[model samples]
Target: MTETRFYPKGEGMTLAELAALCEGELRDGADAGHRVDGLAALDDAGPRDIGFFDNNRYAAVLAETRAGGVLIARRSVHLVPPGVAALVVRDPGRAFALAGRALFPDALLPTGLELGGISDRAFVDPSAVLEEGVIVEPQAVIGPRAVIGRGTHVGAGAVIGPGCQIGRDCRIGWHASIQHALIGDRVILHPGVRLGQDGFGYSAGRDGILKMVQIGRVIIQDGVEIGANTTIDRGAIRDTVIGENTKIDNQVQIGHNVRVGRNCMIVAQVALAGSVTLGDGVAIGGQSAVNNHVTVGDGAQIAAISSVAGDVPAGARWGGVPAKPVRDWFREVTWVSEMAKQRRVPEVRHGRDDNDA
Candidate 1:
């Protein structure tokens, strides 16, 4: 259970109300009037909490949960024990999430210090423009000519560099450094997110490794959430654009001139080299690396730990080193493993070679 001191539950809702909110159906003499105020795992839920079961691995636990109500698929309704009200839904997981939001709305966003307005200890540049309702915390530095929109929260120690433009209702997390970026509304830059740093581009001149001037900016569209410690570089000639609604996981390194389309899911520890382009709905698994100048088309999925060296067509599923189609990759792996296994056979004494010295 979440501690009440840290997170308070919303007003309690009746079982009927929950069913309505989740588009679930309460069946078989369910006590619609029963009140629920908390949500918990099936194994830990008490009489006042709601629990959800989606996977068959938890079928045993579902039978014994003490929750006031349980969200389950129609096929599993028979597993519910007596005295427990079952809310039937197409997807138990989705229903549970909906119910959770209804009961714990505050848990939707990242928690931060509730500094109401500009802190007297913070430094706001004389030329910087901050709209009404913006909250700037202590030790934060807003550079000259920077514009932060209304209802945004700048967390402690955050540095909004000179000439940056941030839109409304955004949350700039603690210690985040934003330079040469234009971010849209409802964007969430989690703690330690580094945006618009110089890209890794250099030219070999007579003077030895000459660093190229990174003149472009990072453009983050609306509803984009960049996880903690993710660094996106500013482009050398064009803007590095992250499209709307892309959810990037923690520790991702997106290099210069990369264009990530809308609704893409990039897992943790993924590294995209400079000029890589990802179309809409693309999903790159954890620890994958996309080499520079490669493009992954829309709806493509690359498996975890894959090393992508070339372009992937739209709606493809690829995996393994130098990633290709998943089936081909698996077949090649199988063939190599079989050959290795064959080589492991011992050279019997009865089969001594004629050329043996």
Candidate 2:
């Protein structure tokens, strides 16, 4: 016999009612009383599932969907099949995301330790404070001056190094290392993340080598989410700061003394050199590199494979090596192509050839 499993349902939302609640005009007649338990794609939706279609490429699947209701863009509203309830909107993707959050809210973790679970063999300093709802998993070490706030979760084999501070609702993933860092509320450090690591600093004297001291700290503000295996180096003199609500993707390298502003979206494999300053709401594409001491203004977008070498104006889009303005780069490309064409003209080519005589 198969074991029974329970799936939680959303409160007070039916398929037809959800479709009517959307601001877009409806495309087909739909029953407002039918219940929907979750969100799904058009192809994978069941009787109780609500699906969405944002692209016209999936119109065939949308027309055959059994979903109770479908959220679709205004342009795609005509694709809704008969007897299907269509929630028309300008951005179907964003609408779908909102619907998912409403249909399946995140459940909070239960508080306090429970019996029948194996505890880890780890060292927690007597002077350290672990607040309510905090969990320190097996083989994890909490230092003497460390304080983990309420609802914080530290995974197994992770090290909260000496003098570190972690705020409430934060998550430290497995095998991560944090030293002399200040992590804010709701921040997430994924597995294998390395924070506050010693920066590459050294001086070679006439006689021998001199190691430069790194006395700075890593400061991550509230609502920041760091991806797995990313490395954020500590500052050389000041703090390596990541502003609030900034999302960093996996395998990114943030060098010492980098200042990133609020709500920035940094994609994977990005390397920011030391002392780089990025204004708020900047979006950096994957594999982009910003040179040292460069400043990127607010709302600037750096496309993928770009190598930024100078200051970028606010709200501009930059690309290519040395990272010039997109318009200027395109103009230069057009000029070069036109010049090459002019040089290849038969009359011009013969004149230039005879001029050598």
Candidate 3:
């Protein structure tokens, strides 16, 4: 069983209410008035908690789950234990997510900065323009000529540097710094995110490495959510652009002049070197890295911890240190393992001195 953590419980909802909220059909085992007070994993769920089962990998766990009610696909409705209420849906995960949002609305929305308007402790420059309904938290700094649109919230200790153009309904998390950037609407920058920093550029010189002056800006499109501690550097020449709805995970580093297309999913600790271009809908796994100037085609998937050195063709699934197609990589691994198992040890020579030769 999964260990449970204590989260403040919300108002209890009846089985009928949950079914209505999630658009699922409630089976007739449990009473409609049965109260569900919390949501939990199958192993951790109690009589008052609702759980979800989606993946077949956890079939054994599903059979043994103690949840009073379980959300499951219509095909898997028979797997529910006797006495447990089955909420059948097209997608159990999606239904469970909707139920979670309905149950824990406060956990999903911003809390500290939502109710309060601009904080008295925040610093807004006289030349900077903030639209109506913008919320600036305590100790946040807004620089000269910065334009922040309506319904944006700048969290505590965040810095909006000079000449930045932030769009409407954006949430800039605490300690995030943005400079020389044009950000689009509904973007969410997590805590410690640093955007528009100078790229790593140097020129060979007789004296020492001469730093090149970065002149270009960072452009982030709408509906993007950058994770905590992610760093995106500005371009040396052309602008660094992140397309709409790209979901980047925590600790990702995007170098200068990089172009990431719409709907790309870059997992945690992924690194894209300077001038790297990713096409739309690319999914890069955790800890993966692409070399400088590489172009990854649309819909390509890079496996976890892979090092990509060249272009990946569209719709390819690649993996390994020096990545290759999934089939090729698996074949190579199998061949190597077979070779290792069949190899014979070299015959050991009796003690002989090199001087004899």
Regions of model 3 farther than 4 Å from truth = 1-9, 12-14, 20-23, 28-37, 109-115, 344-357
Q: Which one wins on lDDT?
A: 1
The residue pairs found clashing in candidate 3 are none
Q: Report residue 335 deviation for candidate 1 (angstroms).
A: 3.5
RMSD of each: 3.2, 5.9, 3.4
What lDDT score is found at residue 53 in candidate 2? 86
Instruction: Quote each prediction's TM-score.
Output: 0.92, 0.82, 0.89
Each prediction's whole-model lDDT (CA) = 0.94, 0.83, 0.90
Worst 10 residues of 3 by lDDT: 1-10
Segments of candidate 2 deviating more than 4 angstroms: 1-12, 16-28, 104-120, 204-210, 331-357
lDDT score at residue 236, model 1, on the 0-100 scale: 86
User: How many clashing residue pairs appear in each of the predictions shown?
Assistant: 0, 0, 0
lDDT of 2: 0.83
lDDT of 3 at 46: 87
